[model samples]
Target chain A: MQFDVRLFALYRERAGASIVTIDLPEGASAGDLTAAVRADYPRLAPPEVRIVVAVNAEYADDDQLLQPGDEVCLIPPVSGGC
Target chain B: MIILTDEPLDPVAVTDSVRRDGNGAVVTFLGTTRDNFGGKEVTRLEYEAYDVMAIKKLQEVRDTLRADYGIEDIAIAHRTGRVDVGHISLVVAVASPHRVQAFEACHEAVNRIKTIVPIWKKEWFADGSRWVACEDHEFADEAEHAHAHAERHAVAAGD
Candidate 1:
């Protein structure tokens, strides 16, 4: 299965690609995809960084099941407004 | 009027969006780029947002205000791209029949935007630049959050 993971903020800067697709084995969880990306883009963040992945615009659990073409997003710590 | 614009945000237009016959009180809040942070001379601020999700969160903020305060005519405009010092970057406008609800709702709306919206603020000073935290008050590279975000949420889930 292929997972389209969207990147933002620091991840975007480090990965240099806003959206990257990861190929995973069948029945891999969201956590598995996150680990794959962390391995692929080791420089995306320091070793201490563990990125949260969102599925279909909402934060998803590590064990959440995958679906084809689900809108997945990486959320960075956000600070906005007055 | 929940929006994220790269152009200069117009306070008057956003305020105008919420005006209606029954609304007597219109409360508007403008967030401007400041020239200083931690007493350091700052140049300009760059703002970014996750457009689709940000709008969804803005709508959620609008719904919360309507349900909690019974105010429907509410508008929020946020600026993206580069915002100069002394320029308006955020506008929260709310119209209500009573002055109190307008004030209260508008106040809560700004807070919600800060809390929920996936908007990031980066400040540039003469020496360097850093991303500001919404509530954590940490000086670490705000952008560095990409790496630690999942772990942070793990702690949040535990809390």
Candidate 2:
């Protein structure tokens, strides 16, 4: 299955691209997607940066399963000033 | 409660929208454009949004507050487009039987909006502009991790 992932804020800057398309095997979980992102993009590896993932506009946990055509977004730390 | 606007926000109107006779306490929070962020002098602010997500998230916050506090009425409005210094960018109002609930609900509403909403602000300084994201309590660590991850990937890619 194929999923379209969005990178926002600093992630967008780091990726140098706003969107990335990832191909995952059947029955992939959010964790699988994260690992793929880390492996492919390299900018996603640990020290385990907390990147919030939204699947089709709803927040999803790492263990959440991904369906085909789900809109995935990697939300970086927001910069709302104090 | 209505949660969106492109025009300048009116705090009085937002407050009035939620006022009730049984509710003795009404708390309103107005987030305005400031002239400075850190050391940079902000001339103005430009707000953008993934409108669909922003509105949905704003409504979710309103619903959560209503459920958690037993708040009767609430209103949340956020301004988009160019807003000059001191102009209101966001407004949140809540009314309840007691002052404590009103205050607490209002505070939580605004905090949730800032943290979860998809709205983005670009601070235009004299020299340049930068996009602002919602800052969380654990922002520094998250930023460091994101930076390191990106750097490692870049190195592997031989960029």
Candidate 3:
């Protein structure tokens, strides 16, 4: 299955594109997608820094399953002033 | 109803939407564009959003607050496009039978909106413009990891 993943904020800048489509196995979890992302984008791999993910616009756990048409978004920490 | 508009936000209208006869306590919070952020002089602030997702997420926030606090009435409005300094950017109004619930719900609503909403804001400073929350990308990445893991296992099990 192929899923459209969105990158925002710093990730978007680093990725140089707002969205990317990646091919995954039929049943891929959010973690698998993260690994795939790290594999695809070495800049986003672990140990350097962590990135947050939102599946279908809501925060999803690493164990959460994704549907084909689900909107997967990568949100960086907000730097807004309170 | 959840509102996503380019027009300036109105706190009074948002407050009115949450006003209920049975609820004695109403708490309203308005988020505005400040003149400065982290020592930078902000000339203006620009907000952008995936409107469809933003509205859906806003509605989810409203529903969650209602369920968690038993708040019958709530309203959340966020502004898009350019907003001048001191202008309202977001408004959240929540009503409950008691003051505590109203206050708690209102705070949670705002916090969740900031954390989960798809809207993005760019602060145009005198020197440069920066996207808010550009550094923290771990939350969404983790979510994606979890979702992918779930899908993989499900496929293995043929479910």
Candidate 4:
């Protein structure tokens, strides 16, 4: 399966690209997407970091299943304020 | 009203929209860009938002506050792109039948927006710039991150 993930804030700055596409097995979970992103773009975060994931605008657990065309967003630690 | 705009925010318009009969008070919050941070001379600020998520979360906050505190009306407007010092970055307005719930609901609205909204603020210091609290509470350690995220969120909500 192919998944296109949206990036924001630090992840976009680090990755230097707003969207990343990852190829995975048919039954990939959010965790698998995280691992693949880490492997592909190490600069996005340190190896040990586990960034947040959002599926269709809602926070999704690491075990959440991925649909082929799901609108996934990679959320770094949010720092919203004045 | 819950909005994400790249244009300037008008607090008057936002607060006025929430005005209605039987509302005794309306509280509005304007989060402006400060001129300094930790002794650094700041020049301006840049804000970004996951528009879809941020707006959704803003609506969620309004709904939650209405149910939680029985507030009558609320409005939230956030700016995107670049914002200079002393300019408004956020506006949260709430109305209720009394003063207490108006203030309380507005307070909670601001708190919840920071904790959950996918908006980000980048501080532009004179010599350098940084994304405040971006990595300070995230991506450092695995075991303590859950706690740190919660604690940082508390700190954020408190502010």
TM-score each candidate. 0.85, 0.79, 0.75, 0.88
Model 4 chain B poorest ten-residue lDDT run: B134-143
Q: On residues B1-63, what C-alpha lDDT tens digit does candidate 3 reach at each position?
A: 578999877789889987878989988888887787555578998877766777887889899
**What is each predicted model's overall lDDT from 0 to 1?**
0.79, 0.73, 0.72, 0.80
Query: Distance (Å) between predicted and true CA of A82, model 2?
Result: 6.2
Stretches of model 4 off by over 4 angstroms after superposition: B134-159
Per-residue CA lDDT of candidate 4, range A3-67, in tens?
Answer: 78899877788898899999989889988898999989987765545667889998878899998
Off by over 4 Å in 3: A44-48, A78-82, B134-159
* Model 1 docking tier (incorrect/acceptable/medium/high): medium
Q: Please write out the lDDT profile of model 2 over residues A1-82, one tens digit for every residue.
A: 9887987655676678888888999999887887888778886435445456778877678788999878888755333212
TM-score, cand. 4: 0.88
**Relative to the unseen true structure, what is the C-alpha lDDT of residue B128 in candidate 2, on a scale of 0 to 100?**
75
Model number with the top DockQ? 1
* lDDT pick, better of 2 and 3: 2
- Candidate 2 C-alpha lDDT tens digits along B32-74: 8889866668899887665666787888888888889887799
Candidate 1: stretches off by over 4 Å: A43-50, B138-159
Ranking by DockQ, best first? 1, 4, 2, 3
Weakest 10 consecutive residues of candidate 1 chain A by summed lDDT: A44-53
Candidate 2 DockQ, CA atoms: 0.21
